[model samples]
Target: MADGETIARERIERLESLAREAVAADEEDRARSYVRRARRVAERHRLRLPRSFERSTCDACDTYLRYGYNARSRTQSGHVVVTCDCGAQSRYPYE
Candidate 1:
């Protein structure tokens, strides 16, 4: 079980890195696919994604958020608002 968890964690990290690279390369579709795969791995393994990967992904549509591209970000009322291309919104508070 520990070894399985380790493999799952490694796969999640690889997927997240690939997603980021795909987004940087302007491949939104590929990025989204990577995000979906990461999510599936997490769910299957009953593992939680790291905070950074969670922040970079959209919960509603399973889309990877590329700042200023598929997603727009703004600070409003002491929270950061991220709006995804699929019309889903996520908010995070800053200190």
Candidate 2:
């Protein structure tokens, strides 16, 4: 492979590893950041990510769940119910 492709692959792998670590550490903010970075890398390479690249949505109210810098600043509580700035909430089975 070309040097650029190799570098992109390496960067994507590192970002994915970081994302997994952030999730395991229960650092939702950090995890979301890494996930976004990874997605960007994938897009740059014209590659497809395993999961949907779009933000998740709340079924009831149809609020788009934001991640990374776009996510709401509210601290998560006991469970993994993520809420968007639009006041829509949905639970995630992280644990």
The clash count for each model shown is: 0, 0
Instruction: State the lDDT of candidate 1 residue by residue for 1-95, as single tens digits.
Output: 69999999999999999999998998878988999999999999999999999999999987778787788999999999999988999999997
- Candidate 2 residue 41 Cα shift, in angstroms, is 1.0
Candidate 2 residue lDDT tens string, 1-95: 78877787788677766765665666767766776776678779876554432335333433234465334533356446556655666554443
Report per-prediction Cα RMSD to one decimal. Answer: 1.4, 9.2
Identify the candidate with maximal TM-score: 1
* TM-score for candidate 2: 0.49
Clashes of 2: 0
In model 1, what lDDT does residue 17 have?
A: 96
